[model samples]
Target: MSATFNFTFDDIPNLERKVAIVTGGNSGLGEVIARELARKGCKVYIASRSHSRAEAAIARIREDIGTDENLAFLELDLETMKGAVMAAKFFMKLETRLDILVANAGLGGIKSELTPEGYERNFGVKHLGHFAFVSTLLPLIQQTADGNVDSDVRIVIMSSKSYENSHPIDFDNVRTTYHSWFAFLTLREMLQRYSRSKLANLYFMRELADLVKDRKNIYVNACHPGLVYTHIFDLSTSPLPWYMQLVGQLEAKLLGINVNDGVKTALFLAADRRVVDKNIKGILMYPGPTDGFVYFSNIYIRTINKLGLDDEARKQLWRFSEAALEKA
Candidate 1:
């Protein structure tokens, strides 16, 4: 195995009496995060679109941790704005507080389609869907901080290193559909959909941090897990022929980290005392080499403007997202 990350599961502080929601936690890196948090005695809700899969994940978590307690499923379908809002509303009714939100559910691949609400699938699910979920849940998170003196409410947004490759947000084209032939011809646009969505994650995190600057103990941040060999990569290769898929998987096996190591930075931001102690917020971070654990950087798959969007662009995104949420 490659040199392990400096941070490990052992470093995560005890999360007893805490509550967490790991979106897309039914599998892959999110599942590992859910299990690790549950291991530390935190009540975790594995939020996803698939109830049966969520239940299975909960069952496996219970079996391995040897406890029926501290694990359950919260159905959250990020494919649509309505699903996102409803899930947040359901959680609001079910629980009084939300301590940690790992906005970890994200997807991208060869397909290009629009959600019912008319957004590109990647942009719809990764950015707009989470926008609705977090917007609906923001009050509860704020209340948790206001009410509990010891509460350090953390929102960990999952962005990708691919974000560096994205150009400015294309508001007009966001809802447009590119035919398969056209999309494949200008493949950059297809890839940009996912990358831009990730950049949106960072934009959301930054704006939230500024909004909560006055609020005590609320930490908002975004991170990338490095390139992990997960189902997402498999999905990326789905449209390819079988032999091509095999070749892609083999390539990923060489280039990407495993799911276990992929989760380190996320867990650190979630439960590490140093986050609150050092007051790390609003910063874009990725796993570092050795010296200091968290570093600010991203991987660019294609050459583009290296800089992120300005504040005006982010404000525009927020306004556009809020308007979109209104439709649901």
Candidate 2:
């Protein structure tokens, strides 16, 4: 492990009257982050596809945080563009202000599969789904910011360091035709797709920061929650190649941080007063050498410049996403 980040849940201030949404808040890092935010007195809506899972998560969070005043569930299945729009509409119905939007839900290594909407599952959920959701909710986010000039409204996109492995997105070949390949090679291909999805997150964040730069009070940023041992792989339901599984098991045991520790950077981006005071936006936040430190010094600058921070690509992605939503 690198030096522990100094930022922790204790650093979060009272969030009374604040309203936030955490996508995929039913499990893993999202769950931990949602629970902590509620503990700080924020009204949190845990958005997920599974009603039962969301309800169970809400119950667990309430029991853990000793409150049910702020926790609720919103149905959001990123598998389709309709789901994303519906999720945003649901939020609008319940609240007038959206203080924070954590686009934290995502998927990883799986067989090449396409959603009913004709997009790759990983790219659709991790990037396009969030792209549509944010676009739909931008007005509300901006309105909230306008009313509260004293503080910042946050949009936190969860990205990953694995994005370093991605090549520029091949708009034409996004939905690859599955064919027979060596098992290990198939794993490699799937991981590359995953990387591409994460790369989309970074690109979207950078471009969004630029698009909304004049807004001032709406802070748009991305974060890499350090490698954590979570059920993200869904190993029981979607087993990996034996050797790959062995390698993953070894890595998890040796290097992965616990979920609680993994969520600090996101929490920092969402609630750290320093981030708001400094007007930090469109940057990627991660942990630093000390336990309470949150690094916004561009550690991923090289990779981001190489693969993520392209002006034309960002515009194309936005256009493509809009078209996708239109078709859906």
Candidate 3:
């Protein structure tokens, strides 16, 4: 059974008391996702690196929703586990339960640099840091349901089409020695690193799905949002020429989809109950024929199979993730 579905923004019924936390919710696809959740009456917590930007996003959500929908911001810096831990702690104190977690915060490619804690910027912010965030908030996620009857705790990981191009993360050199100072070279390396981390996202989701399968209430899925015009490009390691930017602008004007539209997969994976079981674990989703929608296709299944990612890779990533958290 394929895990694909469609729904319009105006159609989501009242969510009234449900609460959600969307990392990177201050801008781009993340902001659009948060707004959509709010439209459904979900109380959304926007987590991002900048307070001012998050505040502005909340204001925009208020304007778009045209109601006193519960929307707020939490400062979360994905470059460091400190920030992730702090955000989780703060959220736990404020909310008794969390219905959804959108691990959407990510970096594209940056010049090879280490964070203050000495992790590569791309993998540090995009994967391991968010990993820490999820770990910190796992308890709240489990608490969303009293005894796992009808209660649902869903996590929608915002992945990218680039997952096709990455390899399993090599712990031997978490900070990839593959460094390049040139803009294009750095971009290539970043793309590879980013793709690898996104693949990790899929594996992690699969592992978590099995870990919580007995709970029968929490749904974990990963998806690619298609070609979205967002800060993702701004974070690109490549020094894009003016012509490229012009082409991008023209694409947005002509064929590029709305950021909100790009986030439809996140919304579908988060709220849809049709295929909430572990049977749909690790399936990558994409936008469908309509606005604010999703559908699963076989274009990437063979690639996943080819990667020998069955049990060995999953176990390895789980072990690596635990050790990384312990080190942090």
List the candidate 2 regions with Cα displacement exceeding 4 Å: 1-5, 177-179, 237-239, 289-303
Clashes of 1: 0
**Residue-wise C-alpha lDDT for candidate 3, range 50-142, written one tens digit per residue:** 999999998888888796458887889988877788879998999998999999988763556776666777667877788889888988888
**Positional deviation of 123 in candidate 1, in angstroms?**
0.5
* TM-scores for every candidate against the unseen true structure: 0.89, 0.92, 0.87
TM-score of candidate 3 on Cα atoms, chains taken together: 0.87
Candidate 3 residue runs with Cα over 4 Å from true position = 177-184, 235-255, 277-280, 288-305
Model 3 error, position 221 (Å) = 0.6
lDDT of 3 at 266: 77
Which scores higher on TM-score, 1 or 3? 1
* Tens-digit lDDT track of model 1 for 37-144: 999998999999999989888888888889959998999999899999999999999999999999999876656778998898888999999999998999999999
TM-score of 2: 0.92
Tens digits of per-residue lDDT for model 2, 59-132? 98888988878899888999888889988988888899999999999987565678878888889888988888
